[model samples]
Target: MDFKNSTENNEKVDANYNVVPLREAMCKTERRLRRKIDIFVVPTVMLMYLMCFIDRANIGNARLAGFEKDLKLKGYDYNTVLSIFYVGYILFEIPATMCCKIMGPGWFLPLATVGFGACSIATAFVKTRAQVCAVRFLLGIFEAGLMPGCAYYLSRWYRRAEYSFRLGIFFSTVPLSGAFGGLIASGILKLPHLGSLKGWQMIFAIEGIITVAIGLLAFVTMTDRPETARWLTEEQKELAINRVKSERLAQAVLLDRIDATKLKRGFTNPITLATSFIFFLGNVTVLGISFFLPTIIRTIYPSRTTIDQQLLTVPPYIVGALLLLLISGLSWRFDHRQAFIILTGPTVFAGYAIFLATINANIRYAAVFLSASTAFALGVMSNAQVAANVTSDSARNIALGTNAIFGYCGALLATWTYLPWDSPKYMLGNGINLACAATWTIVGIGAAAWMVYDNKKRDERQAAGMEEIVGLSQLEIQDLEFRHPAWRWKL
Candidate 1:
């Protein structure tokens, strides 16, 4: 019944009567299935996230197109509006992501997309800072589920080792949205004002409409799971599902009905807490860069035209997008997440240090490239790392949701880090981000070291017969989740 010890090229029957195959025999089939899954599944989620990020981040673009001027936002009012979004975001993320499972991702993700898109559309008509805050808060409530939901959704479809790269592929949309959003905003800003909408209003209205269309398309394009995927054969579905099972703790089923005990294990897991905190630190940089990059660009090129400033924001995001793909691809190829995560420390430290240490316009501008490279890559690595550490579907959902809650709390901090008073050369903001990156390095190193230690201890316990797992029933073994004697943390 232990599929791990199954004979080569043979399918072993589990206690529940599922026939799981030895991974070695399925190489060619897996590659083909992976490609098919990539085509059918990845693109739908990627497009969804691309619009999700665009709709979320376009506020930065809107700011440059005179969003603040039009709304009469004064002093800390802009920061207040930005910070309020995360209040709804932080409070509802876990509940919404939990709902992502109960409602099915195919239905839930698109519904969330529509809700946030409508909120974004509503922003176009806001007349006061209070209106902006209200709309953004609603936007936050809708968007709260999206990133974590997409993460948990993708985790369902891929094996542990394959997750980081595929997640990277999905998250590549973050920087792409930044790039394309800028280009789109630049073009939109060039047009004459419509009936009552200014360039900024046009930006919100147009981008929101596109997001709504994509959300509607997702209803048809997304399949809830492999079993229901019409594009896949029964054979392929079984293979897809079993291959993932082969790598889980005690060969656990991919999806189990959610329950209170499993949910508690998810929220209390040490790996979840550690990775979520690391993600929190990472978000301070990522969200700061996202919401304020346009403002940074404006500061750097004050004499340039507004259109030129928008175009200038494009290059750093392009660089960030490329570096994210390259790094995450290597993480997948090498089958290591923590090492790559630890390796990002120096790059991020140097990036923020340059921003603080320099007054030279050209040099500070170049630092944006270094900063971009690692900002969003952490989101992929941390999510994948947490997903790998957990053992069940419900637990995975909660772990990812918990990760988002902490990460967005950091986002709340980022909103206020760059106040209007911190204008050209926002030394305090750069210093705060620099401190976050340094602290993140320490935490990343600590987490990796703990994983190494715990894995070794587990090995020692197993060797001494103190933690035997042989001949245990599937339910008993699976209830252990990451605590299983045979389960090792993916370092």
Candidate 2:
């Protein structure tokens, strides 16, 4: 009848509760629960993110439809417009994602989507460079929450090992957006003028309307947490919460109230900072390609019609999307994340290197496929790595948001990576991206090595009786979070 005593003793029971029959039955139950979670959660988040991405990057597609000419954007005006989005994005990311946790993702994500969707629609009405820049910045503010919010939300439903694949499934929308956006733009452009709207205006208007519709649907569909998931039975709900806590060194509870100490821990955790830097470097390549691929395609197939160029951008992203899912599945299967991230660096390095080495159209075009292969995949790896390494829910939110903050800084730089002056063979942009790829390879290797070394050190300390939690209550020990001796890095 004593609730506190019951919860404390439950941890002790779970430690020894691994009878094979029980384990097998629980595994089967978990599999069913997982399928239900996937069905209810995954597609909704994926569509939300797909719309988020398409709305953000449609400017590139708009450019192909003479957006610059129509708006009288000259000199570095286009780059300025792109760069301003990241200004609001980078500044708002941590705050927005923190709000996602406090307010609950179900409400936070849908509302943010509506804000950005409306911004996208408003973009269709912008008649000048300054107006577009203003709308884009507001769009960034709304979108700032969705990626890290979704990442943090999924981490609640899944165990550390299960997270990367789900993250990959949703994050695969990055490349999928590129592919779909191009096809959408090309198809839209092929249509006759929609009343008074230009091709580019039609692109913004149509994509924005669909985004708002998806946002409205999400409100009816999104479940805030396992405890609140109406589709789940009582037993399944209990199982969902317990399994997540069981992985976190048998922590006492699944969610904790947000606090300053946990927020600071999230910001200062060494793994969080390191993986975030690696993500920052990867974004330089990812966003650079996202914002400028259409222009690059134009250079590659100079004589091709506008629609053909739009169509050409599709293949690289398709290749990237497939690879993103494949690597995520392998990461989940092997329960290894950093090694795959380390491998991606070299693949991207070769990609940028080829871009630098050739003006030969076919070969450089092949390089786009190579570059696209891993830029987006790193997003899944880095986010999952940070989430896995952290312990508490509040800390996970901050860590993922921190990673995203650094990522948008890289995106800000990406806006200028491919300048108009560097057209037809952009050696400058290629060189910068190649350097990022090389640097990411080195950093990834070092971070992985350090994790292995630190785990061994923690083991040695434990063996020496240095990690005594004897006087601590279960809740207090759980409060220690990642600092607890039982906590190990999920490399």
Candidate 3:
């Protein structure tokens, strides 16, 4: 009887140990699903954004292709055209976000991309300044939701800890687009057989076609979520969904239903207002440099051919892309986002200041490259950092959209502020960019200080509630008043 009992006990221990293989198998399946999602997610987003950014800024290259001279543009007329793009963009941004929520990214994002592409292609045929402005405005209307939409969509798949690195990869395409745009524009400008159609017109026609094609491809392939993705196994899908929810729940302070009323409340919040203002200031500095940097380079190197001028624009974007990747990686590894922003802000300002003081061709070129690259990193890091700090899903979506709108508003202001009339030595434009950079630095400092103070209060509150056994929702914990100890900001 004793021998029999010992054997049975050993068999039970063996059964318990057998469960380990199942756990290992599940983990492997989850990892495979994650890899599949990333393969689709990273490329789709990066490509879409690349096209969006290229379409918006292609005007810079258009200017070099004799666009201004052909249209008889005078004294900020071109500026007005640039600014009008944002009017349509800002008007449609919020609506686009809502549409994404209703329709899912699989449908809405592609439709928007196609619409903008068609509008961009049509722009090539415009004969007058008014026609150009109208086409750009329409294009902006279609493209308005893309950036925020992608940001929000990706958030659905990734955990908060993973978001910054993914965002950095997605955002890195902006500078890469700048680099690729120069190369493409250079080749198109050299084409001689396109019938009286200028190089700039050809650039638009070809790029728009590519955008439409890519959009069509995305629509057919993009799966909305892991649970709904046909490629994922049942176990894989459950793991993916649960992992994201668990991360969000861990970070959330209050758990409220995300509804229309909550959205309205989010839109009206004071923090949202301050965040929007910061986005506006940062974007002014960003778009100002993007639209005018090439022009400024051309002024300094007036005798160079179109190809040479476009080539000159390369170094800045290259340096900018590298620095952006480095900073984003370090920020994620150390969980120290605010400190990086504070350090990067001055690199941008210094770059602008150097450009303002230089007249020598070599020195001016160096300054422009340094400024452009440094500003690229600063703009990207600041936007992603702020977006990560907000806990409400509705609030985050609206905040992201509002921030983009505000940034474009800055772009609109930049259009007129840095007119062709200013040309070679754009004293006003340079000064404005410098001032904007300085102001953003100050804003970064203030945001960091607020985060620190809020964190302290949260710690105190959590300590006081040690005896409570109640389960608080994420929003409640996230709220400043009901602060939880785990509610500290991620760098």
By descending lDDT, how would the candidates be arranged? 2, 1, 3
- The C-alpha stretches of model 1 lying farther than 4 A from their native spots are 1-25, 463-474
lDDT tens readout by residue for model 1, 99-185: 999999999999999898898899899988888889999999999989999999998788877889999999999989999999999
Model 1 Cα shift for residue 279 (angstroms):
0.6
Residue-wise C-alpha lDDT for candidate 3, range 1-491, written one tens digit per residue: 12223334555675546756555665576567668778877788888888988888888988888888888887778888898899999899999987776787778888888888888788888889999999988998999889888887787776665666677788887787788888888988888846656678898888899999989988887776666778777866766666665544233322233466446544654445555666677677767767776788788899998789987887788787888788777766775666776666687788778878978888888877666665666655655665565555665677677777777788788887676666677878888888887887787788778877877776777656544525765444444321334546554
TM-score between model 2 and native: 0.95
Per-residue accuracy of model 2 over 1-491 as CA lDDT, tens digit each = 22233345655675567556655665688899999999998999999999999999999999999999999999899999999999999889988998999899999999999999999999989999889999999999999979999999999999877899999999999999999999999999988877788789999998999999999999999989999999999988888887787766535567888867677878888889989998999999998988899999999998999999999999999999999999999999999999988988888999999999878999999999999998899999999999988888888889999999988899999999999899989999999999998998898899889988989988888754334887767666656657777667878
TM-score of 1: 0.94
Residue 374 lDDT in model 2?
85
Per-prediction TM-score, please?
0.94, 0.95, 0.88
Judge candidate 2 at residue 115 and give its lDDT.
92
lDDT (0-100) at residue 365 of candidate 1? 92
Score candidate 1 by lDDT: 0.86
Worst-scoring 10-residue span by lDDT in model 3: 248-257
Total backbone clashes of candidate 3, pairs 3 or more residues apart or in separate chains: 12
